[model samples]
Target: MKQLFISIFFLMNFVCCFAQEINDKEIDSLYKEDQFYAGVTYNLLGKMPKDVSQSGFSLGFHLGFIKDMPINKNRNIAIGLGLGYSANSFNQNLLINKDNTGSTIYSVLKDSNTFTKNKFSSHLIELPIEFRWRTSTATDYNFWRIYMGFKLGYVFAHTTKYRGDLGKLRFSNIEDFNNFQYGITLSAGYNTWNIFLYYALNPIFSGDASLDGNKIDMNAVKIGLMFYIL
Candidate 1:
């Protein structure tokens, strides 16, 4: 995590320097614009135990509105503030259980009666902020862009599910899951298609949540495509 942050810091610096080298007059001629963004991503668990593994595809999707505010006289460089909603699911072998003491515990399910399908899902309201650069003109719709940002999310709903010969079981509004999440995001590409990456800065579960008496400090990583509309 420390190394990741260090790399991001240097990347941001490089982008800023590159932006400064562009022609000021040309940048000034571009118009500032607001946009709507929607995306679908594949989610992966990061920093998880080797014994705990994903069983199937983990998916996520989000939609949002962004208000762009230009920093320089040239509209090519701007800061964007957005409000969005996101939902994500992870299909894994870990089972979420409540112990006799009423504490949440994550355990690897492995037995004759072990679950055939297990998943954990979360829904969040998000606020995203980004520093953006684009090579665009008022008349041109196709452009290359690089956006680096962070998002703060509040989990409004969470669920855990299990299914097998023992029958299906589900628990909603799990109290042990972390209610707040934050992450760094990057998007870059040309025209209508963009590649997106997100790295969570916080764990998915609260510090008190444990797996085999060890804190389950797992973060989420997502990669996918994003589309923007003016």
Candidate 2:
């Protein structure tokens, strides 16, 4: 009985040691690429109304984490899935206000002198999926990367503010603004600094808002620099 107990203890310890050795080997051999990223963008409105244009500075900020899954043996080619947050503000001449009956109104500002500031901002939660290709190695931290992907976002908070000669008008969570936004993204560069572009596939607003019976079809185009950390 004593001999059997000693044998069992020795076997358990050996098994544990083997398992630990395997774990260490797996970890040491594993190479993971860019799992975190942050970016800044200059926001622009595309396909604008006839007289609608941008003013001031339109900027966007984005940050996220991606799960890098290597598909090839070299690990340079991978697919990334991530969740991120984006805050974008578009400063433009489009004036959004409310009527006396509490209905929303949209119009273009012809005279810049009439208004102090008129702009709209939206904050969203975004999901990003990318096909990643890079010149990266296990020991090399500096490499060139070109990543293209699709991003789907949900606008959780939004606001439109107008401060002008007619006092200040501010609206929260405008119904006309589309809550669901999706776009295509591209990023390419070497090392940490990368050029990024996001072109929205859909309009930012619903078709209910119009100018002189013409549908106000507008989308967003953002181009900026992105930084990634492993």
Candidate 3:
């Protein structure tokens, strides 16, 4: 599965690169004219996808506004700011942790028939700053752009629920899930309306590792649609 993700990253990059080569000059002219825009996007996040290969899918919606300032016109370097909301979760068997002191930690891992079915959901506020380049313009109103950016997110709301043979436990205020995830987002699509995909490089959990090595993988890939709302 990891290899599959790597392949996708490379493929998207290849397509973007080739397209840029063909229309780099044309795109450069228009990008300077459009420095700020606002849009709405609907995203589907697939979390712990390594485990939930068949049934793991989470949905998210984003209403964001971005402003761009040029650093270089030839390379298409710019700074951007954006805010969005996202939520995702999954269910599977796990082994929880319990401490002799302090609050007991639970590990609903990949193994253990103790059967730890859990759900993790979050409401996020994000600020992303990126550098983007554009290529391939069918016209001044429509073109393709490729951007690589970094996003920092704060968890405004987070919850983790566990259910096992022993019944149920809910941890709604703990900081088990890593509140910070830093990664590069590669986006490619048209200017009027585009399809954006993202991959997070960091794990979402920030505690001790359990038997399955905290098998609750935080790496996620999301697909979203972007368009002008204003």
Candidate 4:
């Protein structure tokens, strides 16, 4: 993690210097038209069950194209619509299982399991809409931006995997997993580096999904960096 932070810091500096080296004419041609959006985030599970805990790093990535429409004369403010594919993995200790009746259940694995890895992963096709504000001119390549948006996603796949004393096992197409998800997102920063956050408004699983007899109400929370390319 320390090395990751160091690399990011230097990368941002390099971008700043590179942007400065470019002339206004070139910068204008590059940034005047909004192009693609791509980003990665560190996932954090919020309001998780008391017995469940994260065991390692969780991460997510998105790739998409953005269509930006200027809402102001200066084009500094605009609204954007993006279509994207996103995937996420949550590395944790929770054991996802199915009872004899085939109901999905979430439980904690015993320490004796000596697990090497345990995780849940999902992929989605998503549409994101954003209201964007930026301190940018047609001739400027480096600028500050604030983007707030909401995203709707449909799950295409879901899986769980565990490698431990009992041996490696995987469960695909988990039952009762939510097929649709919606969330609010915010990204704010300067130049190529932006702070990104996402909060899911819906549970990860259907309301009827449970652990033992209790409802599973976990939602995903993600925070990290976002980078945009034009």
Off by over 4 Å in 4: 2-34, 110-113
lDDT of 2 by residue, 1-230 (tens): 35334433553454345434333433334687878787777899999988889998787878889999999988999999999999999999998888999888888889999998999999999999999999988767679999999999999999998989878988999888899999999999987568899999999998887777887879999987777766
In the range 192-224, model 3's lDDT, one tens digit per residue, is: 556666677776666443334444554545665
User: CA lDDT of each candidate?
Assistant: 0.80, 0.85, 0.53, 0.80
Candidate 4 Cα RMSD after full superposition onto the native fold (Å): 3.5
The TM-score, computed over Cα atoms with residue i paired to residue i, of candidate 1 is 0.83
Error of 3 at 205 (Å): 0.8
Measured by lDDT, the strongest candidate is: 2
lDDT per residue for candidate 1 within 1-230, as digits (tens), equals 35334434554454345444343434345456536777778899999875888867787877888888888865789999999999899988888866689666678876624667899999999999999999877656579999999999999999999888657878898787889999999999986568999999999988887777888889999987776766
Lowest lDDT block of 10, candidate 4? 24-33
| Top candidate when judged by TM-score against the true structure | 2
In model 2, the worst 10-residue window by lDDT is 19-28
Question: How large is the C-alpha RMSD of every model relative to the true structure?
Answer: 9.4, 15.1, 9.1, 3.5
Residue 193, model 3: Cα distance from true site in angstroms: 4.2
Q: Which ranges of candidate 3 are over 4 A from the true structure?
A: 1-56, 72-77, 91-104, 107-117, 135-139, 162-168, 212-217, 228-230
In angstroms, the error of model 1 at 24 is 28
Give the distance in Å from residue 133's predicted Cα in candidate 1 to where it truly belongs.
0.8
For residues 93-182, could you state the per-residue lDDT of candidate 4 as single tens digits? 778776689766777785835898999999999999999999888776679999999999999999999888867878998867899989
Candidate 1 stretches with Cα past 4 Å from truth are 1-30, 111-113
